[model samples]
Target chain A: MSLPAEERVVVTGWSCLTALGANTETSWSRLLNQEYARGPISCFPTDGCRVTEGAEVVLPELPWLPKKAESRLSRASRLALPAAREALQHAGLLDPAGRSKLGHLEMSLSTTATSMERIEAFVRQVWEGKSPIQQAGRVASYQAQQQVNDLQTFLGFSGPAAVVSNACAGGANSIGHAFDLIRAGLVDIVLTGGYDILCELVFCGFDSLQAMSPDRCRPFDVNRNGLMLGEGAAFLVLESESHARRRGVPILGVLAGYGHTTDTFHLTQPAPDGTPLEKAIRKALEQSATSPSELGYINAHGTGTPFNDRAEAQAFTRCLGANASGVRLSSTKAAIGHTLGAAGSIEAVLCLKTLQTGQIPPQLHTTDPEPLVANMLARPGALLEKNAALSVNLGFGGSNAALLFKTP
Target chain B: MNTPLSILSWGAVSPGGLGVEALENFQNWPTTVASEVADPARQHLVATIDASILPEKWRMRPRFRRASPISHYMIEAAAQALAPHPQIERNRLGLIYVSFIGCSVYSIRFYRQFQKDGRRFASPMLFPETVANSPLSHLAAELEIGGPVYSQIGDKSCWSSALRTAACWLHNGDAEQVLVIGAEEFEPHQLEAFRSMRWLAKPYTRPFAEGAGAVLLGKGPHSGRPSIVSLKDGFCFRSRNESRTAAERCLAEFAPNLPVLDSAVGWIRPVAIAALKGRTVHDGIPALAHEAFGASCAWDTIRAAQRLSIHPEERVLIPYWGLSQQIGAAALEGTP
Candidate 1:
């Protein structure tokens, strides 16, 4: 059943932090200019990692937060607070001082490895038979919910919160659940997004899996090797149409549809045929009552791995059918690397930008496009006016989620 | 938001035993055992589950062959919940796994190996399970479920939050039945952290426990079945006074006159005291079930459903006082 006019969800604000830039506008501009953010690891020594280059964020100074209070936050929360503040400020829901203007607002955030760096340090201390009292706060901040808690405590929103940790698709899943909450008339507004930071254990794990690109991330390219790890955060403000109108805020776009499905085929590997992802795409389109032909732009998951890119390309071809050749598609991972859990939401912010300003971000470093998506890749500075844009993510555990955004 | 959900079936793999019956009479099942602590003078009270409690058939399943204990508990509890309803379509069932500290055992194992060796020595197989959603993903893969599934991280009161999300899914016709599970596994680091925080109980103050609890919810009409009538949650608190105030406000808005299914473990918490003031409270489950962390509220919910099954005329209110952050309440009524 479709929601009533008053309960329909709309996006009022969005922000992202990526290696390319610190905010959505800068990231989008740098992305259009084809500036690659991949470089050698500097924050921590990449001693034995098979892959050394990564996309790490250079955080801006947050003088608003006390120095002592900020010290307690993990890197994930450190990246999230600024992005969340920018989103709220963009939506006119908060003042410049990082305080909430609304009475009650909920939150739905996602993360795969929440505060792993802190947990690693804590584990080392404990394993060494040393006193872990100093690291107790770090251990307590290890769960994925800790970031949400930090956001609530920082933003001063006293609404319900949920943290979705469905691997890479977590970002879209969090946004999707937020949309569902508003559409179901459970809550009027929600601040939804996802964040993840680079940690030694996770980076080494991907290297152990041989999923990292030794060279550069070349998604949808015929000679693509694997993905490059990145760290960042992205947030969006979604509210019911009635609530937006009541607050007198300008609507950026409409959160048209959300499709969440599982690919029980394999834990790490998606089904080679890409049927499950196709089903997710179809489900999203069905919810919005928008045909495949209506979709103007698509932000493909395109992790630059063999199985993921091939399966995602196949899913797009099958779902879009004839429209596949005409629809503009690109993978921003080629520029900023794959931000893991933040990929879906960061790409979502890009999709909304494309929906609003017809300037589709180009796929970087793809010398020879794969046969499947060769005709669909966008050119640099390509301007294609599209009313609707689709963003999809295929996570590590065969979770596929799609979010469709339409111009209001 | 106030959608009535029929409790199709329930399951548990608590310190008591394997099913809801084990929880219904958990007080007589076994007593809490003492586990060794870092201090030589005293020990910590623990209620851990044995691996043998799981069905032998699960061992042969390739999907669960290398799964962690938390995954096993989650799958076993969900299997039990779906056991009686053989005709329920797997593709139409949604799964939501809620946990506070999730899969810490596997995380510790993976990190330990990585620290011992080098970055290249990090086990790929173990790394994927380090994420909070790993157990739920394993359960979904094992059961071959193709519906919407999510892994929500929160304190004990998140069980009520999951119920609210499940209710939304049911209201939107996303699934015929939504299986909500709260699962946690034992890890020494967690115990040590608890000890350091002084939240750990010495003898019998408030024993710490780990296990899984699940309930299958649907919007279908089933006479005499226990159904959730109201859920008043999203009461975020910062301190004890705030928690008590939140609990009082939640109870007032949810079901002020219903018999309360209290979530107090053993101590007289400020939130519990506020909820227990002039109310018909059922504190037996928390007294016997111990504190399963994230699974605590699920246990309380399952016990409320069981109470409704026997006394169809009673309406039960469950007020949840989380370890931190939020407070909530769920109201359940049995149909005539």
Candidate 2:
């Protein structure tokens, strides 16, 4: 499963927009400071739902794009473009004059709610018998492809673009696909990421499932009830090592391995035993050629739900075995809440930052760690080992993904 | 670029009818292409499927009680494809589902409920089906496909991408056999959107259709199936002319010296026609239109495989272009 030197995919540039801040630096600082971003939901009415708090990203106008283009973009696309632009610029690939270098570039985006707001508006029009099909089609941008299409048009990227829609695992799977494409030599560089925005559909959906926590999310805590929804986007500029070397860009980290699995047990619930998740973690480690003893930190899926946190905790013990107690584990979801489809990439950026700074942001809002994972849970302001780290994501339809990253 | 894979079995559920039999007897099937939209003035031809044709077992299954129409189409098509090889281990099977607009019916319902009745009325059942991966998940659960599964959301060229993923998975030893499905459901709103975008042709010459088609891919050559020669995909950003040029260049890169039977559909037809025009054009190649169905790639691939299966000496070339300027091409050769 190991890739050759020429085929090894490395992270050259990365950017993220989270509820805590607009950029990576600001978000990282806020995370380290243990600041909670959750607040009363204001984007839409949470009238009947018990849960009213969420981490909503306040979007700012992008001067880089034309006013018309900005106005036309869906909220999801608007959040994604800035993060992608920042990643490309960080990799020194954003210059319009150097667009030819992007001939082999590709883009993969992930999202659970792509323009749900616009779709809601369209639905309202249709329901009222005031349907303006043409204008609604232009305004709604309801199809998942429209997100990628908007990015392609805005960035002028000619390479293949696709959207992975596996709910919460969408982001991680998107990055995993990018890694595979690079390793298989299909493309030299890939702009891979995930984005999602706060909408009534998601908020009410989670509420109806009875899986939303009314209070702040507390990951790996005995009293953890349910997850709190959040919104944001994250992107990583992944390139084959040889391509990065040729371009002379700084390597932030190496995308060591990725593993994906599905739990056919249920459509919305994790398997109680966490067997599938453990297998996914083992697969990632096996593919990366890294031993459990070499692992430093784990960014748990840790949605703070009763099922997800417990299952993930058991998965850690089963996968890491003797090394489980020694590895630093925490869920940043406590600080930024759960970003849904964007959770994987956003957590991945945090993992890369942990590798760079040797600081593992603590699991915020959890004073009492769950008994099973207490020994592995990192406290506030804990220092991490400068080694390999693992980030995992689990989605609604039992889709699971684990990504392994290491300092170069 | 490496050795091609084989298409062991295939199935389809289109306006023509259900399963491979319907596809084979398509000519005799009634052509019911008309608008399903509420507005009479905005009428546009669309091919609709009859869900009543699905098997009782599939319809009565508890898992599919709340399933969307697209999911039903996909499950039925997949069942037909897997019917021939029940001995294949479920654990070694993978699923890759592609669509232009996924689960639009459920999406509209979910949004409408939220917009009208407020947040509390959002149905949890409808919410799960609203996601793009709903069909793929439903199919995997129904068939017990425990291996790697991926759901891709893209324009028309997504078929080539699905093929590429399946090939890679097989090549890398991830799955012994992969079922790739392209399914689309007929929704009134979607047709309205298509009409607004002018994607539907006027005068009802070629009607857009809704259906699902599937191809079961396995390693090496099968006794009676066609082997996939190559699959290539690319994105074009410059202009329409540049996109066509880029598509042609990519098509040329796949089996350049071989004589190809052009079966391109929709906007990609010009690219295939141009490639053939440069060389000597061949007669007897089928004239398929894009407006047949949203899963046109699946139909095109199935047709090409059938043709190549009969004519072993000829290679079938399939090219696709999306409204977003994404382009892709595939080559299939028959095994004697």
Candidate 3:
């Protein structure tokens, strides 16, 4: 499904980073080779962390980022801005006039702890009910923390600045919301993206939930343990057709159609039935002009969790019909790790890259899968002749999202 | 501009008052004072009532046991608003909680822990709520609302943004109902500010106070209640004046008695003075409650409307201008 013809949002510029590469091209190349970013958790003091193995993203040691950024910037934003900067640079929308038309938008899940130690101090002092002011009085000495001033202030985001933070579907939700804003004649150009940084709090939470896999994340694999958490960001420059034509911006691809739906089933679990994902997929097609058969590749949320993969596989079959088995499917997490909040946005960048260069990133570590996802690991990043793909993301809140793309 | 949705049921907890009687007393009050969600402890926070025996209703579905008072007030108000519509299931409900700063204690805790343990140790229970959306996620999970959840941390307009988020869910037909909540207590910095001679010297001063508010948006089945007054077709305003214009346009049909709530340093009886201005309003008047909740966060707006349910046909609008002016207005359904 493409957007209601009148409201289709086109992708004019985009950039991203993951275990595969720090920049878009390098990352794409790494993905095709099935090079998994697994190694020691070198950046942080993982001696106290639960796991040692991670798809640790290698930074180029850019002078632009601060030494402390490894601790600050939440993995999501740090990953997001490069892509955003690249997209802006690509679309030639960095100038004064374009800035006005381009609105700033971000979908953030926990990429890093802005104040990595805020909670630990409270336990030391015992949460005294004496006014939060008093509590702060006791903990004031520990206040050497900083956070990005909500994308608007940090990036000088002028037009309609907003942050979307909805667990897994957040990035796609941000894109969908940006599409709404663009279609409704709000902003001509939309800098939309999502970011999340790896943090002990989020990691510990996942560990407690029994969702962390000891080895690399192998989505759809028969012996899947759980998910390996990763951190990164992705962003795309969205513009209306008229604006794109006027600026002569080289459209990377068109964000043909998308859909979002809430399962309303369980907080930590997807519905035993994949109705919500189906509804989102159907709506994405119905809202967009393209049919499911028109979709060349399918990026599965493929969290490697038993229920999610099963539900998602069934949902894919419902959408792709007889072509479900033929459609190219893979989970990039096999190379990178399950980057909770930033997964949606980063995958969007990956899908668009799939459109530009006709290649699919292999879902490494997935030699065998559950009966439902038998065909997911069959083909790695095999690019379809026509550049078009749909990426779906689901999260803890039973939130689901589907984003479609086509070559410009 | 999208016609702003008509507000149906609005409730608030501020220094001004709680239930119906307090709202009427507010209508004619001459001085402006911040509303108090609780009260300033005479001696390091002494408890007057047996909070232990007060049903402890929130404990049953507790997400964070040591959550700040602001979160406590938020849950109380949300529980009240959603309780009425029992048939409205929580599973499909969407929730949004917004604040410039959230339970600053938990934040302070996380920070202090980093200092003591060198960022190596953080309470896993508390870690989930440290993110801005923790409260929203906690609320949604408690209610088993497996729908879209969002949290925004910013100025006064956080509440309206959350409400706007809910309206999107409503417009998109994603959820059957959406709950929007906002609350924050004075941080340590402001608490120090309150202790200064400047705070003590306010001409019409009354010391520390708390305030908060909450509202719910449902698909339909509105029982003739004043609902979704307007759905203004535009983004929320940026500048204070721009916000005023947005407010004027959204509430154009329902002329509200706008009261200037002073968000400055030394506030007091004179602050109450701002609310007492006798303005002629067709539907209802704006009862400013700054003295009640001294920067209690956006919950003050909901409390303001809850305080306004007195006049049978009157509507209440609470506009807060801060870091960025976010005007939160609600049209309350007054019972005859």
Superposition TM-score, candidate 3 onto the true structure: 0.74
| Native interface contacts kept by each candidate, as a fraction | 0.63, 0.49, 0.12
Residue-level lDDT tens digits of model 2 in B60-171: 8777889899989899889888999989998888888888777888877877777677677677778888877877877888888888888887677777878887877786
Chain A TM-score for predicted structure 3: 0.84
CAPRI verdict (incorrect, acceptable, medium, high) for model 3: incorrect
DockQ of 1: 0.59
- Arrange candidates, best DockQ first: 1, 2, 3
The CA lDDT at A189 in model 2 is 85
Supply candidate 3's per-residue lDDT for A350.
86
Which runs of model 1 end up more than 4 angstroms from their true locations? A5-7, B28-42, B201-205, B266-268, B283-286
Cand. 2 TM to true fold: 0.93
Q: What TM-score fits each model?
A: 0.96, 0.93, 0.74
lDDT of every model, 2 decimals = 0.83, 0.79, 0.57
Q: For model 3, how does the per-residue alpha-carbon lDDT over A1-408 read when each residue is reduced to its tens digit?
A: 122346557888776777777778888887887788877766555555456667667654434445664344443345555656666666676655333234444322222233333333333334333344444422321221122332433344533334565677777877776776555554566677766666555665565456767776778887888787777777777878877888887777888777877665655678877988998888788767777667778888988887888888889887888766667888887778877667888898888888788888777787677776676453764657556788899876567889888888
User: What is candidate 3's lDDT per residue for B1-336, written digit by digit as tens?
Assistant: 132343345444443444324433443423323322223432221111112422366665555365555655566656766777778767577777656545565655554564456433546555444554455545655566655566555445444445555665665556677777665554443433243223344354444444345677665434444444432222244433454454454444334464333332232234223333463333333333333231343444444444344444554444333233234433334333
Give interface RMSD, every candidate, in order: 2.3, 2.9, 7.9
Chain B of candidate 1 achieves a TM-score of 0.92
